[model samples]
Target: MPKQKGNLWTTMWISYLETCLNNYLYSGIWFQQFQKIIIPHSQSSLMTKRLVAYFLINKVLEETIRGDYCKNKNIQEQADPTLIPKTIITLNQVEASKFSYIVGWMLFKLIKRDYLMNSHPKFSVICILLRSLCTEKVEYDVLETKLQTTIIISRSEFVQFMYRLESLVIELFEKHNELGSNILRYVENSFLTNLHLNQTFIQILKSSNGENNSELENEDCKFIYERCVLIYMKSRQKTWRSVNNYIPKKGTASL
Candidate 1:
């Protein structure tokens, strides 16, 4: 079992290296590399499963951002400003929808297992890509679908995910206010429909009671707490609400 896991890890790392090369080379070598390194072990390991998702995401993003297909005048005019090289090609609505489904399915699998922590290198890469996707209006459906499908089976892991997500949301808002607002709206809508998620948020809020734990005192957690309050208000209006009580006072820390 250990040997199998070791081989899987090596294959995934090699695939990632090939992806980086493909991103620059774009010489059709990635397909050949994938066939040799990824296909044989594809059904045998967790790392391979994630590598498949990562490869798909990389392919989709590459095609959407720099593919020859996006060179048409009409599509060029609609390119997302936040993504680098504004002159590059952008995905159309249909492509955006397909991309979203792929990401949503990936997140569904990731969140269901505790194997990937928020600090995992590949997990962080996934988050960065998701954040970049948020820059494109056409990709909002994918973000929304991810939120709708995400399940919080573990409180700690869920809290970590929220911390990462809040940072992405704030960064998006800072870069493009309208896009940020739209993403938040989707989150609000998703939270409203997923009662269990709301309850989980409330539970986290309740657990933080006046403690000075290092995790809660971190800047990411502080900002996440603030955002949680805003989202909670939008989803449920109640005079008795006290989640805001957890928000650190002014001058408490620099966020």
Candidate 2:
């Protein structure tokens, strides 16, 4: 009786794992289709573009992370969780690795071409999505570490991206004040705690006076600079609030 119960438990666990793997495969295929049909087409309506970007970003958290996690040789060597009872499971490490890489590549492509920066609505969506992705705690710490390292290595490109991003944000605010406010709020909520990213913003703001003085004379450039200052100040406030929250009260025991 005990042997039968143990077999049943094993069967259930395997079924669960199989479902996860299959779901990952399905999502990967779907995301590929999404990018091909929706992402690259400049003819897409603003709403369609925003929806597609949001969808892709949301999928990155679960599908991309899981797919990347299983790419490790040690993890792959473990028993297949999704195998059916009495069935042999073939692990395709290459396919598994492609999941995370595809998402990263897509994002990089968007960033490289400055697509995200050119469209105000799409840029807003992407920024919010990126903030959510980076700030959220995942089950696997390795995934977070990998993401942070990627950002650091690409800091120059990212800084350039942020310059463009800030310009667009200010432009949007000028055109639609409410939308601009929302964008600033999103940035504060998502990126306030990110020290490295915040520091990069500071450097950009400081350098503007020296290198971008002429550009700043333009009306649009003036608006961008003012908006950037607002964002930087708001970020500083949030950082101090976070720090204060962590300070132990007098006589409180330190953890």
Show model 1 residue runs off by greater than 4 Å: 1-89, 118-255
lDDT of 2 by residue, 1-255 (tens): 125543234445545776785786566665565667766757877677667766665576558545543443232233222221232223268843442333343334333344424453434433333332222223434655653333312223433434443333333233222222133333333333333444544444334335433332333333333344343433333323332332222222211
Local distance difference test values of all predictions, in order: 0.39, 0.39
Judge candidate 1 against the unseen true structure and give its global Cα lDDT, from 0 to 1: 0.39
Off by over 4 Å in 2: 1-117, 120-217, 242-255
- TM-score per prediction, in order, is 0.18, 0.18
Task: Report the lDDT tens digits of candidate 1 across residue range 156-230.
Answer: 333343434333333333322223213333333333343334444444543543332333333343333344434
